[model samples]
Target: MTAHSRDTPQFYLTAPSPCPYLKGQFERKVFTHLVGENAAHLNDLLTHGGFRRSQTIAYRPACESCRACVSVRVRVDDFVWTKAFRRNRAINADLVGADVGANPTSEQYSLFRAYLDHRHSDGGMADMTVLDYASMVEDSHVRTRLTEYRRRGPDTAINGRGAGPLHAVALVDRLSDGLSLVYSFYDPEQRDRGLGTHVILDHVQRAKALGLPYLYLGYWVSGSNKMDYKRRFRPQEHLSPIGWTLLND
Candidate 1:
């Protein structure tokens, strides 16, 4: 039997838990393991159907009475830069990004720890140890990559890499259609650079260059202040029961 035929994935649901995005609401998830040779194929299919991957698992919110989480993807060819986006790009121009394989490093762990402590101290991943961080990067069975961003050194013109300390990092998955930004973190003190917005814009450019049509931004939870920024990527699509439709917001 082919890998896909032999290893059909079985879905499971998580017990209801306090919703992180909305207070006083509970959240449940339907998930399946993405493993074996066909993991990448399965991931692409599930992601297109509104699932988000975390390590080896693909999951989506399955709340009992709420449908707040909506899957979003940018329409790359139609993504025009607003004045604010141009400003963010100009502010972060000094930085250069290098796409590398999924390998864990001590330096990455240090940055991850600092980012969590500074930004998400009260969140679920705040207490992740070095091991947990490593698993987050290297445990994936499908195609995965890490992009490291840093200040361009004088020799960058020839060497094509940056120097000094790392400023940002993005853990992404290569899907058949576009890049899936799994997680990202940066120097919290450098929020003035607008690194978060810069990273997504960079991915959009990368997707266009690669002839991809979309850049998956995971789920946008309506009414969640933390996710409001995602809605700004205009001319995008939202996964609906019928199909992926243009989100005319």
Candidate 2:
């Protein structure tokens, strides 16, 4: 009999399912559990290899017929600040994000529920209950944090914390090279504010401030309208057969 070390990751494959991003296409994934002491290091390596962390599992697309999912990471040092991105920043100038522990709350759950209901009602996570949402935020083996965005308060400048109602939330992982955005949700009613784009922009600044070289944005599926916004963050790297290739266009 042979014993496997808890830190030794073993890969598994999921049964094919309907692709969420594209119509009439099936999707499959190869995954490994990130557990024990080496989880964070393993996560960083796998992320560089194009895997995404969901809970304690790191997975990447392995569809037999499609190769549209491309891993993308923004080059924090050379990030482009376009007119639209500047406008988005200005629009969210009154808001601030405070890093909090990866613990789920009723308030966060309410906003998450509303976001799913309004933005992705037909998606896979639409039926997620509070317990499921809690697991999503807290069931992680590596270093993770939750950034809660809210309107600026009087003490924001002094304390660097926000106040009032929650506007958005970002679940992020701290990797060796960069920050990987696991999930994010925002108030759907505040569409004009472009909270989604604002969140990404904020993460770019945060990563740069922390001296991290990249900000992993997960997989960008070509021809998926849901992923088109990712391309706007210029000077990004796309994982390819050879390695991480620069993508300026």
Candidate 3:
């Protein structure tokens, strides 16, 4: 088949599985593969249209009666830095990061373990092994990157970035239209640091720096408190029945 043919995403339905976000209700998905020369472009379109990426698969909610998963994207140019976000930046100012290859390391695994232990102890990803983590980072067909955060050392002016052990990281996908945050984790012990918010804030900056227009922030379930924070990024666009609509505060 030609790239043009692949351009039209062929959708498929996933078998029903236990819902991660809700209880009692089963969840299903309508998905397509991100592959070939059209993968990047197709991914951009799908993501913009409310799909989320999982490895090489791009999927969206296709439940018969449920429609809870809402795709969210931050407006890079108009994003407002709230007081809390500003404070997070100040707190994590000492932490620095280095964007390494997608290859995973023992250090990253250790940090991942710590993050899971503290925050998601009984969560789905808690049982992930080193190999599983490696695949999570490396098994991708599109443009992907790993920005590992660390503490700044002396002579910071020389590097213009930090130099220390890894404390946090974000798995990012570089798309033609925007930056998609595939997953992120940070040192959970430093709750005072507000690293979670800081990472999202930092990515907004990164997207602006890269001249990207949006930052894909997965799903935002309205009733889910865990997702309410995503709305804090001002001038964000949420996928609606009519397409992406800018949410003004």
Candidate 4:
């Protein structure tokens, strides 16, 4: 049921399911639909409250005894590039991200499918079809964009956005407070290059360019090895009941 403004978010606990991040652990979530004209504003407030958006729904982990999921945001302007981070920047130097229309493409689907198969075979999205992927990208009611990542094509200068093969893609939401990384995936075979962290670093620069203070990296599950890299983005803020608290370096 819908509630009025100023009402605390109605929390719904999900039935037990296999945890996608930590094996042997069960997972649950508290969620609500993010519709209506206030969708964007609601998204901002919920984000600040440690909830993340997926299409029209916003959710936060509400597992019975798990405190693994923690909300994370990077201080874009103050982010100091480390030696490893700098090396990654040089490695994918030719890669450029272009914010394009939220429409899905066959190439994007192919990459997405491969990423799911290789990286998340047992996850919730293992069986998502092209139609589902399209809906995920285009079914948003807030400010959203698809940041297509590609190796700089020859005429990238003229086109502004590259026009060739897509190596990776991120569905992101642009908010008044910061850039939310809704979802992202890359070629799993390129794991050697650390494409995942590169995308986040790239978005931090993008956030800085837009004069936004933070890059909302979404939830970081403490027990999830895949999410541990989030800690590398120095000078970040993690939401706490007290307030947006600074994380220790």
Highest TM-score: which candidate? 2
Q: Which residue window of length 10 is worst by lDDT in model 3? A: 1-10
Itemize residue pairs with steric clashes in candidate 2. none
Compare the candidates by lDDT and give the number of the best one: 2
lDDT preference between candidates 1 and 3, better one: 1
lDDT of each: 0.93, 0.95, 0.85, 0.88
Compared with the true structure, model 3 gives a TM-score of: 0.92
Ranking by lDDT: 2, 1, 4, 3
Off by over 4 Å in 2: none
1 or 3: which has the higher TM-score? 1
lDDT of 4 at 72: 94
lDDT of 4: 0.88
Give me the overall lDDT of model 1: 0.93
Q: What is the TM-score of each candidate against the true structure?
A: 0.96, 0.98, 0.92, 0.93
Residue by residue across 15-67, what tens digits does model 4's lDDT show?
98988888889988999878878888889888888989989889998898788
Residue lDDT tens for model 3, 114-192? 9999888988899999999998888777888998887887865686556767778899999887899999998888878
On the 0 to 100 scale, the lDDT of residue 184 in model 4 is 93
| Total backbone collisions, model 2 | 0
